[model samples]
Target: MARNPERRTALVDAAIEVLADEGARGLTFRAVDARAGVPVGTSSNYFANRDDLFMQAAARITVRMTPDPAKVEEAMRPTPSRELVADLMRWLVQRMEDDRTGYLAMLELRLEATRRPALRNRLTQPVRANFDESARFHQEAGLPGDADAFLVLYLAMTGLLLEHFTLPGVLIGPENDLQAEATLNRLVGTVVTRVIPPS
Candidate 1:
């Protein structure tokens, strides 16, 4: 049977909204149907199981969450590496600021991937793509193309950001833009210095 691309796209978008708003624990076929404004069985028809639905939702959310290179480039036009890195960090902090729910959903998916082999594979694709993008971005910024270092920094930044979001006051004194940017700036500066050698 031919699939309806428009309907599939709508369902995926709805799934992202549900996952972002309610996390994986709250994701249900009926909920997705409600969000998509389709019959309950429609979700099942598009996705055979919850895992499949979650996988698609995660992929769509990842796409939506990732930084837009065009926007980054526009913002960083004629900027040097140091300034560019700062800009990138600021952008990341802004994203983390705007989407705490989505961040928590990603954390839930990460935890679930550990126990579910199928989910593991599905999640790994986005993980690898993120790392690849980071590596490419660093290389473009005239930094060494050290995949290991990129991976380490990526893991550290993501961990710190997720912790900041999830644990809130536990990790930082106050929850504010200045505090978040300061923490991210310090962490990003440290990682950049460690990974990118002085010219």
Candidate 2:
């Protein structure tokens, strides 16, 4: 409803932080306004309701998590191989690590979706599209795996991210030897068959 693109983006970004830090329950227009340092009613003006704000935050997380086009081009320039796939998986983990709040917000959205069917349906489109797009890209690029590989890795990575963020001690820290990079490489290697170049 509020048509200012920049302001809207800012408000949604702030909402993302609130969602991550405070969870869905803590996500209020007042919370968003305080996080954004805007007027108290600014978020209410921008969003139709809390559900609208949640949907917007969900959408924004996708945009924030998308890789840079230049980086994508660079990654794509290499011949598609299991090794390349591992590299890309590592890149994904790195991106999530770098944007921890964004990823955490996404996790919060996933939790919220379980309770709200409408929100679940709204979030499914992009999530499914992303999964399909990743599988399509892998096949189109001649990557050394089928759609199943992507699906398995997707599930594995989802678990990995969940543990890495919500319970870091589970996979990280001095007590644990299962580090993120090594664990991801192993996951990709196990899931994606190695492509042998012709002699």
**Model 1 Cα lDDT, one tens digit per residue, 1-199:** 3299889878877776787777777789899899989976888888878998878877876876887778877865754565455457657877867866566677778887888898889989888887787778777766543667667767777776877777756556675878766776676677667654454
**CA lDDT scores, all candidates in order:** 0.74, 0.83
Q: In candidate 2, how many Å is residue 159 off? A: 1.3
Return the lDDT, model 2, position 98: 96
Writing each residue's lDDT as its tens digit, candidate 2 over 1-199 gives 6799999999999999999999999999999999999989999889999999999999999999989989999988887776788778778878998999999999999999999998899889999998888889877888775666667778877877787778865655544354655765565455444332221
